[model samples]
Target: MTNNSIAQPLEQAKSIAEKTVYSILFTISLSHLLNDMLQSLIPSIYPLVKTKYNLSFSDIGLITLTYQLTASLLQPFVGMYTDKKPKPYSLSIGMGFTLLGLMCLAVASGFYWLLLSVGLIGIGSSIFHPESSRVAHLASGGKRGLAQSIFQLGGNAGSALGPLLAALIIVRFGQGSVMWFSLFALLAIIILAYIGNWYKGAIIPKTKVEKVQVEKHPFSARRVSISLGILIVLIFSKYFYLASMTSYYTFYLIDKFHLSVQSSQIHLFIFLGAVAAGTMAGGPLGDRFGRKYIIWISILGVAPFTMMLPYANLYWTTILSMIIGLIISSAFSAILVYAQELMPGKVGMIAGLFFGFAFGMGGLGSAVLGKLADSTSINYVFHVCAYLPLIGILTAFLPNLEVKRKKIA
Candidate 1:
């Protein structure tokens, strides 16, 4: 064979090996959109359910606690197990739980049934996040941040759509309209089945992957632990603050601005849409710049807007909240990709841990803030939540991570 002919095939092999699978990433992102949209329905219906059931803020808080606990508690174990033994079809199986949850929610007779519905949806989320993260990693083609952002963008966009849909459908037609979302879950299941097929063929088998080289790190185990602790704190700050917005922002607007429920939901949709826009930025920016810098900017940069939100008039409150969502939403993609770099071989575990903690903290924050609102006022809750982002100052403690290149094929 000629030298040029030999070199050409080698180059082509390299190109194919390194090519980013945009098709899979976009497909999985669509699945994420469906999964999170279903989950977001629970909180999106908070106003309607609270009125219908004559629920106090405390009752709302309890419902969140139940759902979040179920979502958060099982994730690590699920990820850890799957890391050892891959389950390609688990994604569709998990979405089935979501399909069932929507049905349960549509016909819920009492608060307990409502709790059960959310709990089932949360369980589906607990399964979806870790495995979907691993799939994104596999399809990343070494562009981890950009890949994560694309994947997360689906989720944030879905979250934004949920409130708007609830306003249009659930609010207009009542709770039974929630069952209409089952069609979404079913669509996700069909798509995820296809992704699972790709996942089975394309994903690296744990046994065959270069486990040792992939996990190489200069930092000691203890340092990695400390850095993880700091990241956890950051997640706590971000999600706790988000809980205030996602769960109670409508109530705050109603109480403070005297807006109708539909109007409040539209504002919530705006804020979450900003969040979706922000999510698309964080991952790629982290890839181009550095995750540490992006982390610092994303987590801390929003503090001023959050602080100003409680004091703003309706016009400015809406503007400030949109800005806050745009700035703050960038943190997760950077944070997740960074942690994956820190412990390269444990992608599933780290995704699970971070996703779980974020959910758990959000739940806890909602419950605590709800009580505080009951005791003081919704205005006070916003004022208190405004301070949570200040905890991002601790980002200084995280060691700067160098991007590690690994074998793709």
Candidate 2:
């Protein structure tokens, strides 16, 4: 072939390769929606389970601990392993665990069985998040922040739906109705299997030594370590505050406003819906402006609303909670994308560590706050949790890695 003919084909191939794969992004996001929707059921039905089992707040907390700990502890290892050897079909296998967990949960007769069921679900989550996040990174076509946000949006939406579904199904029909959610898990497995095929095709094998060299970051070892530490602290602050809302906000509303269970759940749904809405803005804005700016605004900037939450009357409380959810929810996408950029080639490990840390914090916070609620009050828990966002001030200390890298380049 002539030079022009060969050059034309090469240019077309490069353009096709460089394009963002929105179909994969949305498909994975939908699977995330399904996966998290199933996971969210554990917390969503807490009231029903607590009542049926005659459980205390501490028991409720332990259930969360079981689920979150299993999810948290295994994620890093899974991510690390997948980094060395990409497992495209593992996502579907993870969904299978969730499907089984749902069945167990539907028939769980005692507290221990409840723990076992949730632990199984948590195992599925641990397997799903890190690898799925890596998939989002792979499909980004360089728009990493936006891709993470899109991926997160589905999760938040699923979370929002869980409370509403619990209210409609579990509250009306009882725990046996939990089995209905298995259909969601089965659907997710099929979708993830298809995504796995795409992932399999995308993998370009390389030797370990070559992979290590390609994955090297521009920052010094110390800088990357310190930055990761800061990110962890930030995550602790975010998820701890979130734990109070997700785990206890229904109780808070029922106690303070004298709203019925259904009403309380509706309010929780509204807050999470706002979270889903807010999540969409963060990634695209991070792509346009900067991740640090988005992170700073998302975490610290919501402090005023959070601080006012406990003191507000029902109407104002609803407004402030939604405001808090919207702003705070934006931080994770920026934070995840920022960490991925910090340690460039270790996308799976970074996603695993951050996601794992977030789950650990949420679980730990739930247990501690649950105990505190038993001793003090749910209102007290909210009061103390409000200060968490102040940790956002640390954002000032994070060197703008994007700018630094551009300068170095």
Candidate 3:
């Protein structure tokens, strides 16, 4: 080919690739943002719910438990189905379920109804993750780590926005406004999905499926189990950190730190924003170096900050909180990527287990930690939880199989 002709085609191909990548990231991030907003809004709205419904601590815990249990229990099925019969329909199906749950919440009155609605929302949350991870993985030509990280950053972004934005809406429109906000987010997501043509089967290879039995990785599976255990511990610690901050942060600042509500909110916003940025960075770094390294580093790096959280107040605490937020959250993107990669052949199932068991159990841990904090000092809990990540660092040295890229034909 002539030099000019070759150069023109190469540039065109580069442009197309870049556009496709941006589109993929945008769609993934938007869906995650919506999901996280729905998830996080509950904690933010707790005080209002308590006043209106006369909810007790146990009641609040139960409501939260409903969401966690449903999501955890159903994830395996969602994952397995997606891996086996992977389709673009997965995203829409998940969105449909989520919308139904959100609608239910919007109209709900009694506490039982609210619980059921949130449970449904959790189920909906469970359905999409594995399928989405698979799609992201395929889209990136099997650069699964980076893809997973980018995908998760979207959710973290939503998490960061949920409290600040939803708090504003709740103040203006009252508690029920949160439900309306979720519904709006739901509708927006559906519309965006259609507009982006996110349903295109770009991830699926045009090949026939054959029932093939392959040798199971008995050794790797054992290692994965151990790794899963390590993650569970890490999850427990992080969840405690998260729940403490989300559920009681403002109160803590006011009571313990002696800061005003407005100041606490500002610090909280900064902390969450840093977390979102850290999550985005973690994924690419994991992809470039290794997931294990990121996890270990995050554990080690964040521990001191978490420990310092109880001692300092005001400016120092805010600075410490930002540091803790970044260090602790960096693992999420890497961990999600790691979990999905663990069961390479069944991306959905792996996603389910990690998010379902590891992540879900972490929520439970948060509850326990919260109870412990109520009895003792929240500072004590933070210090205790810091050690769990250190344990994870020990397991970081375990062997991991490198993910191989499938060559395009």
What's the TM-score of each model vs. the native? 0.94, 0.95, 0.83
After TM-score superposition, the amount by which residue 196's alpha carbon in candidate 3 deviates from its true location, in angstroms, is 9.5
Q: Pick the candidate with the highest TM-score.
A: 2
Off by over 4 Å in 3: 1-20, 106-110, 188-200, 206-220, 258-266, 377-383, 400-409
Better of 1 and 3 by lDDT: 1
What is the lDDT, from 0 to 100, of the residue 189 in candidate 3?
Answer: 57
Cα lDDT of model 1 by residue, 260-321, tens digit: 99999999999999999999999999999889999999989899999999999999998998
Candidate 2 lands at a TM-score of: 0.95
- Estimate candidate 3's RMSD in Å: 5.9
**Ranking under TM-score, best-scoring first?**
2, 1, 3
Residue ranges of candidate 1 with Cα displaced over 4 Å: 1-17, 205-209, 212-215, 403-409
C-alpha local distance difference test of each model: 0.90, 0.90, 0.66
lDDT by residue (1-409, candidate 2, tens digit) is 8999966755654454456899999999999999988888888899888889999999998999999999999999999999888999999999999999999999999999999999999999999999999889777777888899999999999999999999999889999999999999999999999999988866552222224335457788898788889889999999999999999999999888899988999999999999999999999999988899999999999998899988999999989988998999999999998988887677898889888899999999999999999999999999999899999999998888768768877
What global local distance difference test value does model 1 have? 0.90
Over all chains combined, what TM-score does candidate 3 have? 0.83
lDDT of 3 by residue, 140-236 (tens): 5445566766777777777788778755676457755656775655664575466336445343221111112223443456777777666666666
